[model samples]
Target chain A: MKNQAYRMALLYDFYGEMLTDRQKEFYDLYYNEDLSLTEIAENYHMSRQGVRDAIVRAEAVLTELEDKTGLIRRFQERQKELRQLQELASAAQAANADPVVGDYLRRIQGLCEQLKQE
Target chain B: MKNQAYRMALLYDFYGEMLTDRQKEFYDLYYNEDLSLTEIAENYHMSRQGVRDAIVRAEAVLTELEDKTGLIRRFQERQKELRQLQELASAAQAANADPVVGDYLRRIQGLCEQLKQE
Candidate 1:
């Protein structure tokens, strides 16, 4: 479930704008806010089925965009590299006896963290 | 002109899918393929003015998507960071007197180059 949520969050971050306003709102409430379809329907005066349909369609749109562009996949791959670089930096920092080189490794570690956010 | 082409390429890579098929073809021919507007129109049975209009509208769509998403901008910033990381690694390697630390810094430098390609 956590992995599914992470993938959904990344996909939504990349392509959720392609979804309609209502789709966006419902998706946010459903996925990010963890709202039930019935709860969301009641809150928005929508049929539960209607809310379900909207959220499913929105997910489809996000998935289609991701399938075509692979932006999210590319981002995840980049993140993996950043994490590896972070690991290497930590290892290098530990091995390095030079204070100045250690400082540089520390900077590289910080940069990896920042780029992961990107 | 070089800067414009770079920005256009980045924008097109990010959001060109939102454009129509004809618009994509025309944009590729004009900006990437270096075809003149008249040449594109002649090849595609479009009026030169019509081709220009299609291309312009397509450019607008690309630009608007960039404005809203800023994916291209984020990528450019990340590229900038990667370049700086590369420079820092090189400098740190030079400043370090230890052979093992230098080897570590070289690996970090290589990692920076790889991430930049990402």
Candidate 2:
């Protein structure tokens, strides 16, 4: 499940980068807005296959972009690392001998919070 | 760049949902592992276009999955909303009459931190 979430997150990031404006509209309608492909076709005044092709092309672009870049992959790795750090911090807090661990956790937490704000 | 990040994230998530084990291996080598299609084909003992088709089909699957689910899109939207909220809280804190805004920011910060751990 975690792997699935990470993959979806990366694909989402890649598609946004590589899709053209029309493709983005269709993608948003189909995925973000949960519109059917048939509905997207009607709204865009295109045939079902046409919409399908656009989506396909957009997907290829997204995949190619990911093949060239590792941004999302890196982000997922960082998130995993952050989780490990948080867990360590929690464990230390439970031990009650190292408030410094909690401080580190809080600092990492602040960085994550800033990332969300970005 | 932000939009690119979001798109890539979604595509990654979608691809993770739909790929088979073989496809996953190839995809990891090609994208996350930064191997070329030709290289992957050589490694997998497949024809060049066969590798191409696999990647293409995988891309289609990823796109279809995204079309059906909006997990990454929702995450991006939430991140954007959080940023806006953070900005609002920061501005309120600057106004000097509402330390409550600072507390709210800290609380939201904490939630974001927890999300990272997850």
Candidate 3:
């Protein structure tokens, strides 16, 4: 199921770009529509295993995309940076001699907070 | 390296919970602050390999956290769902006369777009 989860993660990353039209449809149905594998099979008029294979293959492609392009990886990196920046700003605020630094930190903190909410 | 990337991804996901305070500092420096591994080693007052091990071990812990808790995985899942819902809504719009479905789809699409921008 690691393979499934990895694929799902990859597909999630490049849902806009990677999938062929039919694969995208099946992917949307299975994952986004919350259709059961059986339901997908019935809807697509394919065997359960066939539907499963498509999902699996699509997931592999997605994972490959992530490995090569690092879109999701970079997004995750930014999040870490924002959190650290917030902490640094708080530290500066505590130091109290650097109001300018504090102010900058606060602004960054606010932006990060907004991003987290999103 | 895949291991490094995997570790970074994991650390990003559970940056809140798993890392010790010192480990967090080092991770932020290397990843968030974009410090070189050598710089991190110098700052930490350790051998380069020691610093590298700390980072490697820390990354392993983060990956382990993803495996166990799956917070990042779930977030990715939600994003996929929103995209699929948007596509369905567009399809329904093209078909027409399903105002209730269309409205629901539009609402979901709006929320998803908001989430992605975040």
Candidate 4:
């Protein structure tokens, strides 16, 4: 459930602008602010069911956008690859004593850091 | 002009599905298929100005999305970084005689190649 919530938050980050204003507000309150449906409904002067429906619609829209674009998936894959590359570089750096090889490994690690920090 | 067209094509690749069907068709015909505004207008029974307008609208929509997301810019930067990483790995591989250092460099090069192919 936690993983799924995090994933939905990321989807919102990428495609939330496409949501309707009410939907965006409800979804953000529920997901990011951890608001209860009753609380959100009271705040907006809406029924709990109405708030639930809007949040669900917003989720569907965000997810459909992600399905079409695959941008988030690609971003995650690249991040994983960078992590793996960094680990391998660190291992190689530790094993090698040659200053020349050390220099190259250092440069490679720098590149990996830059990629990951993005 | 050629570089700009290529960049527009890439923007289309990222966000074309969001455009209206007619906008997508006209943009692809003009940019991807190299059709002139006149040719596209004739094929679709649209005025030359109409075809031009649709293409321009599509371009504006794609640009707006890019401005909001910056995904293309990040992709280009990562690709450039990968190329540099590949070159450094290759140089290290060539300069080192240790099979172990060469092995690490070879693995690093493999990772770079995988990333570039994506």
Pick by DockQ: which candidate is best?
1
Deviating ranges (above 4 Å) for candidate 2: A1-118, B1-9, B97-101, B113-118
Write down the worst ten-residue block by lDDT for model 2 chain B. Answer: B92-101
Tens-digit lDDT string for candidate 3 (B1-118): 3336555754564443446677777777877787888898888788888877877777776665456445577667645644553454354345444344334434434544655553
Better of 2 and 4 by lDDT: 4
Tens digits of per-residue lDDT, candidate 4, B7-72, equal 898898888888888888888788888989999889988899998888888889888878877878
The TM-score that candidate 2 achieves is 0.44
- Candidate 4 collision pairs: none
Best by TM-score: 1
Give chain A TM for each model in order: 0.88, 0.74, 0.72, 0.85
lDDT of candidate 1 over B65-104, digit per residue (tens): 7776678888889999998788778878877887776777
DockQ of each: 0.58, 0.03, 0.02, 0.55
What global local distance difference test value does model 1 have?
A: 0.82
Report the Cα RMSD per candidate.
2.4, 13.5, 19.2, 2.5
- Candidate 2 at residue B45, lDDT? 90
Q: Look at candidate 3 and give me any clashing residue pairs.
A: none
Q: Fraction of the real A/B interface contacts present in each candidate?
A: 0.46, 0.00, 0.00, 0.43
lDDT of each: 0.82, 0.58, 0.59, 0.83
Q: Which stretches of candidate 3 lie over 4 Å from their true place?
A: A1-7, A97-102, A114-118, B1-118
lDDT of 3 at B21: 78
